[model samples]
Target: MAKRRKMNYASPSTNKIPVIFSIAVILIGLLVVMSSLKKFTHTPDQGAIEENVQMKNEEFINRLVPVAKELHQAHGILPSIIIGQAILESDWGSSELSAKYNNLFGIKSFSPNDDSIKLKTKEFKDGKWIEINANFKVYASWEDCMRDHTLLFVNGVDWDPYLYQGVLLASDYKTAANALQAAGYATDPDYASKIISVIEKNELYQYDK
Candidate 1:
């Protein structure tokens, strides 16, 4: 019989090389998958968060424009002023006083029998901010709150019937905003500036027309 050629077989250690290589490839694949998952689960960046906030604010303003324009037509109050005060006082309708109770203008209730809720509010006093609990008016709806707001400007308080008449007489939002501060609509010294800033920043004057 002819002698058979010697068969060359892989050594066990050599065989393990392929197995090790396969394991390393699988591990690399797993690492890649984990990295992809990490990227997918990341939270929104500051810019994205800010964009969402801006969008929500725009939505709030748009929703109020129709009613504000109507109020302006019925009363002489500037639409820009109404919308600006709504945005500032209610925090775009996110404040608990406005969101739950529909008291958009922070109108207070002096009578215990009135429909109201007690809440903490900040007041500017003695050149410092102080928190106090007070009774805030409640309304059936946002529309009612807005109507009451306009009536307050038109009718004024018990002490003075023409208190906010200056606001209604203002030709522009700036003057109206200042008139609000002058009439003591809010305790904050910079209330007028804040309203003006909100109006200008959002181009709320467009609604005046």
Candidate 2:
């Protein structure tokens, strides 16, 4: 008897297996797509967040702008420096310096012979920084400090950053920041950037330049 020839025809059972595998692959692909979409999806609570920020900024301006204007009018100086100094040193007028001293510029006592009342400061005496109970100019009011600032700048004090009274004062904020940095007016790590930031953000330069 001749050996039976092996049949090469695929049975219905073979077709069923591929169909089941294809269905599983399609389902897996769908699941993968869904998971990828889920990971990147974001629900935006749009207007509410922006509105709160705007409101807070408005409130800050409402409370603080008068002080800036008063400082500006009292002395022919641009209020941006005062406002920037106040905002930076005072952390938007919340620091102890702002509350009690109201000396926004961190003005140090330059002269012992001078009669301006002073604050005890830490100064390097021999090798280490020592706390010296010495005089630092005290202001009866913010207006007084503002006046002193004006005088200090008018005299072209070494640390007068803007040197506003100079004949060839900087025409813009960047120039002022650079001139100030070169003049040793500020020891801030980001003095130029900070001043420029405040000037630009608040549009405070409009008052003078």
Candidate 3:
């Protein structure tokens, strides 16, 4: 009779292969779940953000209307345009520059003699927005800022005395808006439309009267 060959016993490590594979699969699944959760957590709640901004805008307008009326009466600058510009440039007086320095018009300092606050700002230049550090005039209060803005139109900047004549000559808010764009009050191509929209939406023309 032929002698039976002894069967080789399988190693214990080989028996554990299924267990290792199951652990790896579980770990991979957990990683995928964690990645999905991370993405969900980082997504912004756009509606909530927008609602907060709107509430702030309303509050700013309320606080501004009386002060703006008084300034306009004194300066003869169109209140509608002033309010619109303040809303646009200051983000309803909530921007850092406006809140801290009372710079509502984004006017840059043209002379070394001018007292200034240095800050990072964005400009619409050569068909794109560019970042730069600029010297902006500082003010003791929002009233001072309003007064200075009106004076800027009447007196012009030291560098260009005739810079604001177009805006100064305009007969109405719409005309003033267009003239400001022509005078390069802002570099945005749609600056006139944006100003006009703000004026109309808030019935800002009433303040002009």
Highest TM-score, which number?
Answer: 1
- lDDT of each residue in 46-140, candidate 3, tens digit only: 99888888788788777777877876676667888888999989988878889998888887887799878899988899889999898999878
Per-residue lDDT tens digits for candidate 1, residues 72-103, read 99998898998899999999999999899998
After superposition, which runs of candidate 1 have C-alpha atoms over 4 Å from their true positions? 1-33
lDDT of 1 at 68: 89
Ranking 1 against 2 by TM-score, winner:
1
Clashes of 2: 6
Give TM per candidate.
0.82, 0.52, 0.70
After superposing candidate 2 on the true structure, give the runs of residues whose Cα lies further than 4 Å from its correct spot: 1-76, 113-135, 158-168
* lDDT of model number 1: 0.93
List the lowest-lDDT window of 10 residues for candidate 1: 60-69
lDDT of 2 by residue, 32-67 (tens): 999999889976577888887767755655565576
Task: Order the numbered candidates by lDDT, best leading.
Answer: 1, 3, 2
Name the lDDT value of residue 54 in candidate 2.
Answer: 66
lDDT of each: 0.93, 0.63, 0.85
Please state the error at residue 187 of candidate 2 in Å: 1.3
Q: Which candidate has the highest lDDT of all?
A: 1
Native-to-model Cα distance after best TM-score fit, residue 175 in candidate 2, in Å: 1.8
